[model samples]
Target: MHKTNFAALALLSAACLTGMSSAATPAQKGFITGTVVNEQGKPLPGVEIDVDNTLSYDSSLITYTDAKGQYRVDVRKLPFTFQVYAKMKLKYGDSTVNVELVPNNPDAVAGLAGGVRDFVFKPKPVTAEDPYGNLGRVFVERGIGEYDVDTAQVQVTLTPVGTLADGSAGKARTFKLLPSGGGPVIPNVMWGKYQVTATLNGKALQIRQRTDGRTPATWGAAYTGGFTRDYNALTPSMFLEVRVPRAGD
Candidate 1:
């Protein structure tokens, strides 16, 4: 029994010295670090970052920005080189969207070589090529059991309540809803609070934000999934529900 144990130990030592064992060398490692900042060049803290290592078994790691808007991720360096990329989760009002972050240091996209890779939230103009525009989607709905009218003629207005995310004074907008029943989505609008109002054929309609899952009264109306469903930032982005209110309230 003693001889057998000694022989096995000797064999393991020989294997390691000959580089024939997995434990012969430790896995190499490198790190990636960066800071997140807003478009105005102010540091943005508490931002979640995803560091993806493409073409490697060790695929990804997650990190968040500190109070100083800085983050770091340790990555294992494999013999075969692979590209590394970073992504970020950004908040627009009550909604959140994932953006593929472009690093200021372009070389960071290549194999890991410890360096600074900063990110800035500089939104570009919405174009056909970029469907994920900087705008937010607001779902508009006419309350059930409400008076019927032509949606095309309904004039909807959105008045900004305060300064926009970029600290610019927001402008009021008015638009007509889609007539084909395809979309209640308000077009070309930024994500923020808005005082919504609507007029149908010169008659005012009662408006409320159903973002809290509160539904207007539907006399004897039945829904498949019931009338209430909780949503983050209403549904997807925000919801503006309008209905003709009965008199004497």
Candidate 2:
């Protein structure tokens, strides 16, 4: 009778252990699926699609689209926000989309099959010229063979080359190139010889120009003196600096 009771207690302990094991198992994983379509509503094949897991500070996950413009990203049960980007070739440009994944809401995912959805992409618009009424203007033309200077392409920065009246070098100013013809304008510059440097990618190219009281009010005025050197050999980070004197100062 004691042996029988010991066996029964051992069986109960085993059952409890099994239950604990089952409870300790991790939750089922979740997935993000989507289709990529172009402006004409056609499935774009060979287009590079990138899915970036934005929820975590590390940005730990990434995936690409398949032949049918379909993509899937499998992740643990945790909720996350993802940034999707589609790029076709080099010149055609790229597009972006944002999505949030929530596995806890059954009703929110009821309509999805395999947690998949369709995404449409459109090209980004060009940036407008600077509207500040500064007296001096700086013009930066996007180099050839480069598309969309605003992001993921090329960046521009501007700085005063000489020293200020206080015998200290002035702070450097940065301006980014836009698809449109206009960019930032440096106004009220004291009339003096100044040099403007254009940095593309990270390389520097110097351009010498004089900014006087006669500087135009339009954004294109920044390019008045034109680049002294050829820009063909310069990289995206290369820069040109223009020298100018303020109108009356």
| For model 2, the run of ten residues with the poorest summed lDDT | 97-106
* lDDT against true structure, model 1: 0.52
- Candidate 1, run of 10 with poorest lDDT: 220-229
Query: Over the stretch 185-247, how does candidate 1's per-residue lDDT look in tens digits?
Result: 453355556666777887877765643445453321111111111354322345556766576
lDDT of 2 by residue, 1-249 (tens): 011122343356345434433221123236655556654556655555455555446564456667776666664454655554544442101212122221111122211122444444432211133222112233444333334333322333444445532134645445543332233332222212233444445544323333233653222223322122123311111223332223442
Best by lDDT: 1
> Candidate 2 vs. truth: CA RMSD?
24.3
Q: In terms of TM-score, which candidate is strongest?
A: 1
Compute each candidate's TM-score over C-alphas.
0.47, 0.31
TM-score of candidate 2 against the unseen true structure: 0.31
lDDT per prediction?
Answer: 0.52, 0.37
> Which pairs, if any, clash in model 1?
none
